[model samples]
Target: MLSTLGLGLLLAGRVGAFGSPTADAGRRGADDLVPARSLQEEVQEVAALKPITLRGGVLNAPPFAIDNGDGTYSGFQGDLLRRLSQFALEDDYNLTFVLSPSPTQYNEALNLVASDCNTTANPNPREECDRFDLIVGDYYCNADRSLRVDFSPTWLRTTMSAIKLAEFEGKGITTLTELTFAGGTACVPEGAYLSEVVKAKFPGASYNDCPDPEACIERLKSGVCQLYADDELALKYRALNDRSLEVTREQFNTQYIVWPLSEKMNPQHSRLLKKWMYKSVANATLDELSYDYFEVKFCPLGLSGPNCDQDCDPIHGLSDRDGRCICSSTKWTGADCSVEVEEDLNTYPPWEIAMCYSFFGINTLAVLVCASWIYWQRNTQQVKVWQPFFLYLVLLGCLVSSSSIIPAVQQSSEGNGNVPACMVFPWLFSVGFSITFGSLFAKIRRVYILFKAAVTMNRVTVTVKETFLICGILHLQLLEGLDSNHCRLALGVDDFCISAMLQDSQHRYQVFRVQVCGGRDDPKTGLFLRAAVIWMNDLFVICIIFGSLMHSVHFGPKKDVNIGDAVSEYARLEKESTTALKERKEKFVSRFSSIDSSAEPDGASVKRHSSGGGPADETIDVGSTKTTDVGSTRRLSAQISLASHPEKDEEDHVVCETIDDLFVEDDQVLK
Candidate 1:
């Protein structure tokens, strides 16, 4: 019975379900069976196999990779690993994370992955070696490390940043340069890549190595180190939790965070891991996980908030260290610096403007009236002597000067129009001053020339056209100086184009100080030039007044000394002498006629003799009287000729009886 049972079991094992072994082998070879299997059967075979598990190295760094101490992990890297794990599961793989046990620094983790632990030649193997298939901590990708191990695609791109105690906030250590120049000690984690960066970039900064990131942070807090350098995101997280800490606004040494995969890792697994990482980036899943851990989103420049949707006002806003908009200028306010602050404009009051306008109007009217009167009296001697053309120019200058009030008021009232108004104001006032002073100077100079000629007894003739030419040349010089110097000077006046809005001590309101033409802060050269021109004009006026006094003293009722004066005086004397001679001749002639007609010649002759001389003898006396009267008239005429014709020889005794005759002969020539 035992021999029969053994034979039956052998037969059952040899000829199993499907066919005999020899028959199955003849139908298909072992290599051919793999291809011959149905797709569903192959899937079932793969499902029956155990999942390919990968061990990932983790660190205690918060916000990047954190160990919960309960055999679970959570953080930016932690969340990223879990998300990658889901992709692995779909493709028949598993991810197992293990925190670094001893020497839990990022460099140690990288070293563990870079070391060969599976070879038999190794005497002792670290537990880290067994656990680390890849380092999932915040490992910076660099050329030195790339030679030691492989790296995944970049998970995060960030820069090195520093953190300090809040007490050192405004100690002029806000920038990396300042911190480096200060020669303060910095706490750098052991084996961190940032050590090389600090040594190379900021050689002046003295750095000490701490055992771990936490130790470095403790050193920074206790004042053992002035600053702690780390990845920007990690420092920002620390600053958010610890109010006593402040992250520097400046960042340095751009670095990329990546997973350092072991060189011995399966090529298939490495490819799948990289594939999923790229997918996560494409779908924004990596960014979403980053936000979940960091509680802040990275935004483009000049933007902030959770969603990065808020815009900072470009003109007046500045972003703070934490990405919030702040008003950069006192003239702006509100959340994003969009609203302008109300300013109390420093300007002339309405009453002042009105008063100025009133004065301008009155002066304008007076100038117009004077100009009109001069025009109407242009042919008169008083107006002709002063040159009516120049007189009108003086009045025109007055009107132009008064018109400057318009722009002055406009600039003060409407600050926006300051530049144009300021430009116009200087030109008007300067041109007017030049015109008026130039005209007055020409008139005074003409008088001075006449006085000089009289004193020197010389004949110097200055025509009206020549006087106008001199005045125009003076005015041109003044106006040219204004155009080249004063007009440009007006442009450079303090706050000429825009009002200076300054915040008061209380910080409630802004004070807007309007710029005026020729402000006190104008250049010294411009002021000096203006003063010099005014002084020259004033000197001319003083000289003119002094010359007039001297001229009156020199001439002093001596009309014959000047031929021009003698001509006028001789005309007056001649008229009076002629009338007196006529009256005397008439009396003599009437007396002679009465004596001839009278019977008693002796009585008549006595009467005539008593009256003056007799007739016959008295007539001879009358003839003598007539001859004496005629001789007296001729002598008076000779004196007039000598006085009037001083330009001719005295022997000629040629007289110009009237000023009109002299002027008619000369045809109104100016002297």
Candidate 2:
């Protein structure tokens, strides 16, 4: 089945171009473009001494060989064969192109090549064509052919893919193993060497001997065969024009395309053909032809790549002539790409293991340093050198605490229950010290205010020292009490003990005393806890000392006057001013009363006495006016003059002085 398809592809080559041309033009195997020395000069030199006649297949090989439709032949391979023939004949008889049309209906290319009468698809030894003078084309010179005819060191490299009708896709048939397992039948051209390979690989696979590759494809289309297997190039040739077929990625094998000649051929002719074919294999002409037909492929082996010869030899699926292994792609290196690296974390090298430390350490430090610097510049007011240092310490706490959290996370990931005591203690110390110091720094002024009010400078000095000493003692207290049954702050029994000692008044001092009596490391908690406690206690002392200093500066009143007395003085002055105004009004009223009494009674006395209680409630003066109501005084001025005038009869009223006189006693007094 495969043979018929391959034959059909071969016959259809001249109809249309297959695959892409320009796109794949340069994709010939790795060596396809490598320059090679010319064998022409050497062949010509040899030709001077010998006459050689080299005959090859006359039929067209498409891109390789063509019939030319006349008595002669031309094509890629045909041209190459003729050039080689000329070089081999060198000053000899005419080198002829013989027509070796497929003899058997199968037209197995090898059989044609093997026939004594002609050379065909390739040279072979089975048909007794071993006596041929010379031959070249796209031929697979197998081991048998190799013994019958010498081949150039480097042969044509092919990348093979399985091509099948699309209808057979997804049938669970891929490898020969799969076909044999599925109890499926296969078809191939009779006498093709691939038949022997398939039979060996899949002993149970049933196969039909088709006449040619095209027949096998026809049988496959007709459901007479489950599949046909052949080289990717031939299958691609058939699939190019037919939309009903497709090619797969799986490869059956890789074979070399080489030349063959009868062992009897003159050594000079054989050598010339060998050298020309090798050079041609790397030439541009073959590459151009290869692009239009087959999928250009390379022998990955023998290069420095993982699959190269030093890794895996192309001829065998195993290591090559060197001790170095051509590693399979399954192994990828992360370093220089030489070592076989493992995937498991446990197997990772020390440097890789340390990667996590670098990541966490550097990153944590960067954040802490930057944050601390920003915070210090913005919020700290004292401008003390220790301020940044303090901030640095706090940042250190944050970093340590953060690092401590990693162990827990890692433990969770690893599913390990053991908690590291060192990590736990330091994390706790950072937390406590951070909170304690932060609060102290925030309230420093408040502490100073309280302290300076209660102590003198000299006493303040003594108190501060005592405070620090007590702070140190308390810090020591905590350290020694760390592991005590009633003092430790751990999670289990030790935690209960720490809590009891710290919280129970009766046990607190005793806990400290006990620690003082005991030696260092006598069931002590840890150094970090001790250090953290010391820091916190010192912070407490600073707060207290600052408080005492503030108290000494502002304690009691610096003068006799109190803040309240100044307020009282303001109130007294305001009250006195209010009283003075009342007294003046009373004295003025008395004087006015005495004057009215001195005026005596008159004819107007009744009218005056009835209306005049004192001065008029409101006195109006020309250009000015003064109006007074009992206990209240108001003054107004008008510029208009007040002069007596003749009254109108309708509006005028009589005015009597007292009861008889209306003349003013003193106008000056009125003014």
Candidate 3:
């Protein structure tokens, strides 16, 4: 009876009995006898059994796969898986994802999936036997990994690099070779492919393995490691957010990241994954997805070539957008910065040198001639009155100031080689200015004091010693200038000591027109110091001019008054007038007495009158006449008048004489 049923169904199928409604009634009756299942019913039964759910294992790597803490995931790999799942759904493939358990590092993520199949125990295990059908993250495609799992088409291409604290760059650890030679400890994720590269390339360096990238970074931050080796993309991402971290410019070991599939995964599913990945790559969707997460394109730093295999010098070469090398400084030139540029020595032009020497010579000659003349006229009143000591100082200052031109021109000729000249220029100029101005200020101050004393009738004397003391005080500015120069030399900007190179259109080197003392391109601090010195000198000049004006106005010819001599002569004249007046009074009284006695005739009565009041009256008249005739008193009055109003013609002579007397007195006191 079962054989009859199966044969009848087979016959019904052949006769198209169940396939079309247009079948004859006879065929339909036969199919009803067989009781056959329909195609829709079979599909429903298959669907009811279970869906082909693919378990995808993801590693926790930022910008690749990040767990949302709510059992969801996101990032480049996450978005890629989502899009691949959507594609698979259209083809009846159900895809699901699962993150690696806590503390599952990148190097161990693949092993978690690969270990599930136990292929050694069962060579041909069921497709569903693996813990994960595929693993995704920044899994590098390499021969060692390929033995355990198959890789999908390349998802991302990047190079391996090391990251360190930003300060390490300043320590000259900007390149891989530098880091290796420095013998610093490197933090590497346990079982990471980078460990192999680090070991092979950096034999000089020691390394410590952390459970994962985060632990490695922690180790780096905690000072356990000076460098952390990882993929350039991930390291760059990490460095972008952390200002203290920096990615090394020298990257190596180009790697391709891909989804790792379990060795026991169904071949059909593996084909589907490869097809999807290749399609995404061809359509630029993979790059678009990468941009959605990374938001930046990857390019090896300071590397240039058709395949980015050429390395440019990190110190002297720069890579352009097209990955071609360009020289960053004039010190080097060539495609890869392998050639050293020859620099032409530049010096001051003949005319400038000649001019500087001429000025210096002329100044020297003037100083010598002035000095000789002053020495020859040492005994002259003009020279003595002017103070030979101060005159010599003025000449010395001129000589020193003019000598600064020597160093200035010499420095120009020597470029940055003349450090001593650079320091000497300011010292010479400043000290010279201080001496010259200070000396003049002292002289003017002395004259001002003298005139002031005369005007106020005060006994104030400004001696040569006091003038020298004042000059010495003013010369302290020299020390200040010295300190400023010293500071500039000690803590000056790099450019101050470094000479700049310039090439003309004709490729001719030009002299570095830098003034060692006060260059125009000096740093703000240096410029401020120089400006302060100039302002101080200008202040001195203003003070000198003002003091000179005061001296000239107060001690003009009309107002010349020698208080020392005038006061003494006035006192003498007053005493002599008093003595002369007393003498005349005495003489008058004696003469009146004699005349009264000698009177006769009317004398008896008159004598009585004269002896009493007449004689006294006669004595008073005689005294008045004698007082009028006293020439000494008159001469005393004339002398007082002359002192009060000196003759203009003699004013100059008197001033010269007064100055001479002052010096002479000082000389006498010193002797």
Candidate 4:
């Protein structure tokens, strides 16, 4: 105690003697605190020029990028982009954010920006395309994406996991093997990395696909799919919010997340981006971001439900509740719990709980609309042959919507896993798509023959067997359910265009696609293709049974009358629609040229650029989803134009006419 007092006295004496440390080294120390390169110098390296605009994509995933219903984006990623611009370019660059439209479009948007082939500003003929420099939002590094584009350093390392209701965690699901033994299906986004592990580790188990995490949870709770698999962070977030769901394994595996730069980004801009990433990591950007997104205090994982150790002050609420945090005051919620609410609920409201219901609502409305259209034209004769196709579409919509599974259309987004939608949607989605697109394709093929056929063949019949065969080909993910769509949400996807499993980092993040449908169609060529190979083994049996029988069967003057002339009229309309497709394609190819390393964005200029595409400061439109089906196949189809083939002369203009218009010519002939 004497020594401590003596030391304090000595420090006071020294202060009296020299006044302060500032007296001796104030000038030098202050200089030392500044970076070797002044902010001005850093700006100069890139050259202070007029602000340049860069195009990028915005994907809605909370804590990363949250869509603010009013046409703006909020959350960690949104903030980071602003910070990065300030830190990297000193706020000199303008960013034009476009909605990616799907999970897989994360990289597509990046590549499109890099390649300048999005057909946005400059029409086809690559040299004149509109250009975007780079994009960032829940992007993970993977081998497949590496081939197509370059990525900045890994930004975050993601841990993969599966989640179940808290009460069921005590069940036999302690391990993946047990999950398989239990025989309960796991739910995942279509094509997610976790699905690969599920298939290999839990080979005997079945899994279903959902459009996203919230949808997956809904499926899990409803018993459509009993388990949910995804990245540990997101799963952890859900588990914390809804005490009902618990993360089975928080650290299943980790993968590096990164912000991808355009492959063709200017060298200066690339360097600047790298510098920004380095500085962000070194200068507390990530630290602050983590605190904001992951440090919520409302009954966090360890303190949830029965495990809670504290209670809110009685002044805030009438009483304290177990397993949930009760704030002492409305002004501050998590604060009284010794933690702070992640963000202001008013400024950043939660994602619409009933957004997923759009899958059902929209589809149901579509069914009603189509049915009504058919009813009105029931006696018109023009609608007779079209009824079957439209009916098929209505059935397809029901399956995709899975209204039966997602019963509580307005259910809160929190703890949505295990709803019946997960299980039922997958199988129905597969069957629905197979029947929908398959029928459309087949019918179009028949019309195509009649219109363009060199010779008038006698009679033709497309029996259910052929439809079944065509439908079978599209059912590559049938066994797994609708996982392909979910797989896309977890980027760096592999074969079947599936995301990479943590099993092998080297092979992680591979997504195989053959561009079609006016260059937007992404086909399942990798992992799902392997499933295709296995499915092919069933081919011989089908051929032997159906081939002979089909050959022996003949039709009694199949549906259409004077098919040749009817098809002729349809052919001309198709050709005109083909022209529309050509114009559309010519319009989307883009090359981001206005961007420069030293570009300084004026706030007004950035606002101007973003405003032109939409009615807001940020081009904030939700990417059209791959139906309610998991990423398994919808990403490949969601935004793909009906022009399956891009050629000027011949393209699949399947949707050029409504069912009514499609059959009008045929009806004319029959009548």
Candidate 5:
């Protein structure tokens, strides 16, 4: 039985027609995005631009790109484009932000900006320098871009340094070579120039990027990218909130910024646009813009400008009101708003912390302990009828109690960060429930065999013959029961596909028919009538056979009498007292049989001594006897007359005496 159940579960679990409906059906389009390239590669490709219809995606310039409602562009890129639009159209040109439906579309827009199909910031000259001019957004000057376009002296100049993790301080990471070899890695924006420098200088070091400086630096707290490497100004904006990061390496190069114009660019109207773009790069022009966009600070005392304060806090250099930190309402202060106003732990909310702990810590073992207590209190010393079922239930409870085992083992063995859901539930249910059902069916077969033996001969061993016959019959019956429609949630039908059929009353009749006829169709009613007949027929046969065997063995004929002289003399007296004779007959047989003989005569006749006042009664049919009842006077005389009586009378008296003895023996034997 166990083997059969296990095989059934195995068959159900096989990669066959019974697989889950939702296994690999649906997927999202964004999941199909292509692999990302390095920042250097991205910049090189973006430098090569061409024309296209639409260009819109999220612009990631920290403090510059603002995500405004109604999907229209704003911020530094917005302001720069408006000024240049006067030169292109002689009026302000408004750039509109549009949502990219998917990652593929988003990347396509970025590619367009790179190719000059639409506007883009800081396209390199090596790829598409002649394709289009940079009208808006910051343009960086490189050795390659300088060959194709003109440059201003410089709009912004700051230190270019490597920001090592604070933990790695005092480790002598002065040179670019030492910074790369130092156990920590760095991060840079996807298309930024500094990302290129790190990749070139230290090919073995790990570097990552994000479009925005704040986002790129946030990875440090997440432990994604350990160090943020960018222009000093951008890193300073990030460090205002997270004061732990500090620049470890000295400035490698002073970066120059300029707007490039296409050689084939429309010189007729674009000349004025180029002049305005350069004019906009003036010191005061950028300083005000930078101050409005970001909370800037001068790092180190010597680099402080007139606006830069020498008394600025060392942690942030200087505080801008809108930076990440804020004063607590209760006088608490910290970088992440984690400081306490009072020293008491009770002042801190207790329930919330407890709830958080429970969410992560509570397990099935805790549930099992509670459940076991309840079971023990209820069951005590009582034996359960479904003993095997209860045993399997306990086994399942144990498995649940140790539920952490599989997950802990898997993680320790495979070194994976996550567990697969599909493998857990499917396999667990198959194993646990199979044991439960197998044990349950086994007990059922056992009880049935015991019953069959006791009813038949009163003595039958629990041999293989009885066990196999009983269990096999029940197992086949179980299979039949499983296939029945009502038990299958009453959903089976042959009209349409079975799975597609809904559970409605209309389908219920079909289910009923299938259950009754065992899937056989009847010609007259077009239903399965034979199923009910066969099922009931088997039950009826078992009932009749069992009942008959019990009856025959239990209430078979009784022949306990030994008819000697004693039995014969009782028979003579019994013949004389018919009332006693009738009562005794009824009393003896009433224990085993329900035959009605209670209406027999109450007295015997003296003439010819007939029982029941008639001819010899055959109520006791074990033997043939004719005894004449002699009256009381005659009874006394009969003893004297016995010697004088004729041979025929003596023969009759002998027969009666012998019959009486037999009745006495029979009665004693029966008792």
Candidate 6:
């Protein structure tokens, strides 16, 4: 931004050509943006003080600017000034051209324009820097100079090229290595940036020290230099006037050709210059000026960009060494130069392999501990009952974690490797989970079947034939192994074993969780078919572990004495007490019958049954005992002689007995 000081705007009055602006209307549109009254007055006041413009226009670079013997400038630069003179500065300030620049005088021109040339305390500023205004030239733009001077955005790109004698061939993207073994020397101008590239490529190669582009071309003509290298525009211009020279059809390095305005140039003036030239550059007004100066209808432009097509064209006598196309292209990268990349779906990437190691280690340790626990506690009744189910879990874990100790080198498709993980884990998982879920399910099933039997028919016990099915399945896996392509993940889409062999262990873990939790495949791959075979390996593990831990659903209660057994024992005790009482009564009655003379009274003939109960006979009462026999039932009664309720109603104190106590399920009374 330009400072708001009034004198700065006055110092910024120089008028110079930068680039062209797209006309909102035409060149006359400037009438709409009239300059400030103070600004216009300042431009006029400055112009009166400085008599000559002394514009920093390049003098020696031909076709750009030419110094005719007359006291006026002519060439491409003149035409640029002509276009810019009308609208670049305020209308009242007279714009003029002055001191011409050359390729060799870049530093001098910079110092002169910056007003640092006079180094004294009372330093007098130069006309180009302080008074007359701007300098124009094909200055190589760089950041170092941009700080001291203000250079415009590139008006045009100066493409560099190599020129050879007539009858030379080869047209393509510039090869950085082409001239390295060219078997001869490459001539370049002594002071240009190209000298650095040439020197670096061939440190000891012969160099034709031409002072300028013109000298470089002369050396090419006189056979003093075998190859002449310079900017493409300059070479093409030279080649146009001379018949012996030929410019390579390819373009290589390029530099910026920009208009350099003084740092002291006014911000408002710079903005106006930009507004005017932006359209001119875009619309190619300067290119048109080059065309007019060279008197050619068509001119060349910068060659193919980074995105040039890589289709080597044989008809144009051009070919691609790398993938770059020999002709024009629209897309970037010039991609179709090689066969498509194929990522190994059966192999793990570094990070994925690392994660697999972690999973395998942890799971393997857990499995080993479980197996050890099962082995150590095999005698325990709980362990004994669940031995088959726990065996399945151990085997599945072993398969899941085999890679922990299985070194990569030892792994093979037929043996212990990723192939086995895919091939065997599924079977192992199925077997393990079958026992796991089967046992759990069987418990609930046992309850149902037992209840069903108790109510209707007979008991149903779980058959041990499940082991045979697992054995059959194992034999089936062997059958698959016999086939040539059995366990292969996918012959074409992926190897047999698919992504289980490819994905990280964590991914596989998530996959199993997803399968169990939601019945969905891993969302990452969404490959359910393959994942099914993969997850079926651990399905039982997931079901058993997850159900037991999460839902509190486990196998049946451990076998121990229960309330039903206790009630049965109590029933046996009651029957034994009754037998003891009957024995005691028999002993007493046998003893008393031998020593007594008693009267016998009976309702009818007493039917002898048991000593505890018989017919209603013998009017004698033995300690409140009474008995009766009716049909097939014998009733023995002991009177409840409540001392407190001697006159209780008969209904309340008659008898206490239930049908369950009187008869059992077989319709037999308590023995």
lDDT tens digits, residue span 542-636, model 2: 33543443343347334443423444455566567667767755645564564345332122111112245653232212333433333343222
Error of 6 at 110 (Å): 3.4
Query: Which residue runs of candidate 5 sit more than 4 Å off their true CA positions?
Result: 1-59, 64-69, 80-135, 147-154, 164-177, 208-215, 241-249, 260-264, 281-283, 293-671
Candidate 4 yields a Cα-based lDDT of 0.52
How do the predictions measure up, each by TM-score?
0.40, 0.32, 0.40, 0.36, 0.29, 0.34
Q: Give the per-residue lDDT digits (tens) of candidate 1, residues 427-474.
A: 777777777777778877877776656554567777778766865786
Q: What does each candidate score in C-alpha RMSD? A: 25.0, 25.2, 24.0, 44.6, 32.7, 27.2
Task: Work out candidate 4's RMSD over C-alphas.
Answer: 44.6
lDDT per residue as tens, model 3, 548-614: 4335444545443444565556556656766766765575456445434532212122111234443
| TM-score-superior candidate, 3 or 5 | 3
Better of 3 and 4 by lDDT: 3
Predicted candidate 6 versus true structure: per-residue lDDT over 143-169, tens digit per residue:
666766677766667776778877454
Candidate 4: Cα lDDT at 598: 19
Candidate 5 global lDDT: 0.44
Candidate 4 positional error at 20, Å: 29
In model 3, the worst 10-residue window by lDDT is 618-627
lDDT of 2 at 83: 45
> How much is the lDDT of residue 261 in candidate 5?
41
lDDT score, residue 456, model 1? 42
Looking at candidate 6, what is the lDDT of residue 465? 64
